[model samples]
Target: MTDLIPALRHLLTLAWQCDPRRLLRAAAMVAAGCLATPLIALCLKGLTTETLAGRGGSAVLLGLAAAALLVLELMMGHFAHLAYFELGDLGEVELQNRLVALAHGRPGLEDLDTPRFADTLALVRDDLPRTRASLEAALQLGGLAIQLGLTAVLLGLLDPWLLLLPLLGAVPVLAGNRAQRLLDTAKESAAPHQRLGRHLLDVATGHATAKEARLAGAAPFLLARHHREWQAGTRLLGRAHTRAAALRAGGQLCFALGYAAAIWLVVRQAQHGVSPLGDVILVITLAAQLSLQVGTAIQLLTVLQDAGRTAHRLDALKPLTPFHANKSDATSAPLVLTRGIRLEHVSFQYPGSTRRVLDDVTLDIPAGTALAVVGENGAGKSTLVKLLCGLYRPTGGRILVDGVDLAAADPADWQHRIATLFQDFARLELRLRDNTGIGDLDRIDDDAALSAALDAAEAAPVAAAVPGGLDGLIGRSYGDGVDLSGGQWQKLGLARALLRRDPLLLVLDEPASALDAAAEQTLFERFARLVADSRARTGAVSVLVSHRFSTVRMADLILVLEHGRLVQAGGHRELLDAGGLYAELYRLQARVYA
Candidate 1:
């Protein structure tokens, strides 16, 4: 209960962020309702007594007051619901948008892969709505507190001893607090169940895992595991609910006993002529009503306590810092990489890992020239491309784009001037035009530009096959959709990279991996033609990462990496003549296809 206060405060903060005015208005309505509760209760007692005393006109007047109180309660409840819904909706939207922005601005992909960060993401995605609902519950609890306070004041006025009857209801409040603790313990125990549930959901819905599950015939096994997790969660919840019911029953028994005691006191006082019958009746009636309100307040507080715990988890997201930007006015205007893009004494290790993926890697690619990066698996080839693309800042040293330090450059602005095709590129489940056009949204509606990119990537056949040409849906999951083969998908990805009309630097990582030798040659030929055309127009730079030595040998320069260090840097023929790591790997691959 004590821990819950901070959580409640945090939820209030989020609510305030949504719309402070709405919250205030809702609170004001609840306060008015609370102020009216005693009046309504007293009016009922007075109307009953007046009717019994043959004062029909006074009874009629009191009846009208009761009717007005009922109308006010309804209005207050309506406004409260409206405010809560609006606040919850706004908070959920803000939280989701902030999370997406944070994910995009994360310095590296590795940062997003950590378990703790993933857990935080899951909490935000799945638990944020629940937490917001809990906040609404907390607000309702506040209204209940107001009602309880008014009831206490009215009962106290009737008889000082009757006030003790409301205090006796605290036993039930304590019982509810105990039940809430048990519920919290149950939720803690179900954490593993929740984790398993999430894993099952991933396996069931993920595209990549479906093929493996079908081949292994493991759907039944996975389904059984999912069921087991659900059962475990339900079992914990059931046990907690049983305990809550037992505690509530005990509380109700205590409350009943307290009411009986108050009734007996009122009767004894009336018999002793210490109080008039009318006053005794009024006191007894008020005590019963107050007891009911006290019970309701206890229940609401328990709910608020549980909500507070959930709210605390959501509060952790409040301090998520926005992406940092360079203060200096750095224009993203096109600049010639005359001395080439250079990495000087650069090193990088992913967070939580001791092994450095790139170590003191110094290299250069001349402006308007092509460079190919080739290495064996785990040889840090891809990490180099990431560093060059500014996806990851160096752990040590710096990357210079035509002598301008990339670290001091605006990341968002700099990224705009580069086009990238990652090894694990996304296959957008959108229209063909959108898939390519997202690379350059400004020209998304330009049919000529879209057609040019498709032609440059040798993806004209794919575009022709689509029902609506560029406008046709790309994935089978959607209506009127068609899925492409792996090689065709690669072509589409290349088309996307080509769609970036103003890209000064283009990075291609295993872009031709899915293509056959003939297709690869044709694609590379078209790519060369496009680059030659672009060079004639703008002198754009291209960087390729590939395992195919034959494909890379055509590059102006080749880089060989071994165990996170640059081992060879020269033209492909020059490296072969030098008989270094590049030559050894090239010969080894040539032997396989000999």
Candidate 2:
């Protein structure tokens, strides 16, 4: 409670950053509601004292005063609750957007792939909404604290000894706080089981994984695993809840005993003629209000504690500053690429791994160039491409664009000028148009441009087969939407990349891996023409990563990579004459076709 002001200040800052106007309104409502409760308590005490003492104040007037304050408290409490809920609902959308953006702003998938980060993200996703939706907690808490203070004043007026009653009532909440820690600890302790339970449930019931489960007749095993995990997590939670309930029950007993002791003292004072009859009445009213205040305070403290926990968890996540809306200008602003991209002694090693994925490699990709990157498995071809697209920053050396250091370039703008279609492309459950249109988000609704991109990707046929052309849903799980073959999906991926008409760099990793020879050739032909048009218009550079030597032969320049090193670089004929790694791999692939 000592650090309560600073902690709450930080939390309020987070909410205010989302929407200051709404926060202000919510806070005002809370204050109005909280003040009314204490006013009502004081008014009731005044009415009780006046009615009992037969003082100068009329009984009817005192009754009316208490009634009016009671009505005000009721109205303010209800309105405050409604306003708090509305405020949270309004902030939900903006807060969710901020969280998602923050996660994506991480530069690479490494952190996302780690179990610790994944768990934290999942919890944050769930906790943030719950915390935001609890505006009632804040208002209720304020009212409870204010009511407690008012009760203390009334008790002190009865007799200075009676003032100790409210303090004694606080024992239960202190015990409850310790009990609540057990619940929090239990949740963390059972996290592994909870995760396992969720994963097993997904495997058994999810549309994609369900097929394999049923086909392999492994449903029973999955069901059994799900049952076990659910039991494990539930058992721990149940135990914590039970223990907390017992402790709270004990605290209630203690409160009842203290209430009795308070009433006894007030009655004894009255019997000895040391206290008035009105003082006894006031003590009784204060004791009852004190109990309510303690309970309300406990409820409010629990909510605040939960929200504080959520904020702490989110704060612990790495690199949250990158996603702050105010910091978007320097890094997220668009970068202009005119001349080319140059890798000067570029290198990268995955965290916790000693092996460098890309060893000191220097390369130049001139504007209007078709560069082919050929390598065997684990030669770091994809890693290099990820670096170019700003998915990951290089651990060593630098990437220069038109003589400007890539590090100094606005990351978002730099990414905007590059588009990549990897071997494992995402299958977005969206309409056919959105599937491709998302690549050029600034003009996603441009019907004409979307059509042109589809044609360029040779995905016109894929669209024609669908019912609604651009609007038809393309994922099986989405309504009665039809699924595409791997080749069709490849074309869809290609269309997504081509949607960016003026991208300075285009990276295609195994673009036609699933297509037949003829289909591959046709897609490549369209791609070549698209590249020429883009190159002429914006000095575009395209990188092709493929195992097919036939496709590799078409690139203006070929760079052969082996074991994270560039072993060969030249035109296909020059590499063939040089008889290095490129020639060796190319001849081997050609022999298979022969």
Candidate 3:
């Protein structure tokens, strides 16, 4: 109960932020609805009394007045729904937008990988709108309160004993409060179960895991786990709901008995000539009307409690402030890395990991040069590329572009001047043009530039094969779409990287892993030609990571890493002559082909 107040306040704040006018209108309509309810009860009493008094014309006038009140009530109810719906829609949209922004602002994927965070995302995405509607219903509790107060006052004028009738209905409202608390506790306890279900669903449905599941025959194992989670969640929900229903039913019975007692007392008073027929009629009518109002209030309160549980999930996200760059550095023109890229004693390890991925590694690359990184698996090859692209920061050193430390450089500005094709590249389920255009969305529609990029990346064949050329859809899940082979997908990814207009550096991490030997050879030759063209156009540097020694041999400089440390750095022939780790590994790979 203590936590509920703050949560409700927060939801109200979010609602106001979405649209103040709509909220105000909804509130006004609800107030009007409350007045309409009392007006309806008054009209009912007047019509009954006038007909009993044998005043035919007066009864007719009272009937017409009651009909008018009914019409007004109906109108208010309709408009209230409209206003509430609008507010709910706006609030849901606002919450979703804020949640997306908050998720993206997380420092790294570490925060996103937590089960708690995942649960929060699932609830926010799936339950926010329902919660918003629940909140609106809860707000109508004020209208019910107004109607209850009005009914009590009118009944009191006839006889003070009738006031006790509404007090009897308060029993059920108190029981509802208890039920709400229990439901909230149950939901909070089941959060972990919900998260487990979400994890199972992700593993079952994810594209990357689909092939592995089939090959390993693991579908049944995963399905069993999913079913177990669902069963556990269902059991918890069932117990909570059953308990709440029992309490509510008991309270409702007590209220009903109290109402019957009140009516019997009114009848006894009329029999003794202490109260008139009209007065007895008024008392009975007010009691029933007020009882229904209290019932509605209780139900609305329950809904509000349920919505509050879901709102807490969305409230977990924290906001991030914009990054600050050093003011001492002057803002350069569009291009900045004119001289070279340099890493000075950089060291980094992933979160919660003891082993370092990159340890005091240092290197430099002049503008227009091709640097190749070669190493066996687990040698920090991909980690280096991530750091270079500013996706992750070094724990202990600085990366400099043109002598300016990247930490002090604006991240957005640095990203604008770089392009990367990671090994785990995104296969966006969008149009062919959008897949490539995402590399540089600003100039993606430029046909001449697009054509040039496609040609240079050896992607022209795949593009021509697409049904509608660049405009064709590219995913199997959608209509009229075609899926590409692994090698063809790699070429499309290369085309994406090549489409960048002002990239000062290009990082390719095992870019040809999917291609066959002959296709890789031809692709590398075209890649070299494109690099030369790109360098001539914008003086961009290229950093390639590969296990193939033949590919690194074509680079201006080759770097060999062992156990997170740089073991050898030189041109390929120089490293070969030195007979170090690079030379031994190169010969080992060379023998595979021989």
Top lDDT model: 3
Every candidate's lDDT: 0.78, 0.77, 0.78
Candidate 2 per-residue lDDT, tens place, 176-273, comes to 77777787778777777888889898998897689999999999999898999989989999999999989888987898898999999989988999
Q: Which stretches of candidate 2 lie over 4 Å from their true place?
A: 1-3, 10-69, 106-115, 176-197, 218-256, 271-278, 318-339, 431-433, 461-489, 513-518, 547-550, 559-594
lDDT (tens digit, per residue) of candidate 1 on 1-594: 575677578668878888899878877776776666667767887887798799999999999998899788888778877877888788778767766765564555655645555555565566556655666666776776776677777767766777777778787878888888888778766666877787886786578687888788888888889989988988998999899889978987898888888888878888998865666666666676667676776767676676565455445433354234444655453554455677899999986788889999877666778888999999999898888877888988898887788877777777777888888988897999999998888889999999998988889999999898888998887776887898999889988888887677888899888888889989788767766665555566788899988889778888889999999899977998999789999999999989
Worst 10 residues of 3 by lDDT: 319-328
Minimal lDDT window, size 10, model 1: 317-326
Q: Give the candidate order by descending lDDT.
A: 3, 1, 2
Q: Return the lDDT, model 1, position 347.
A: 98
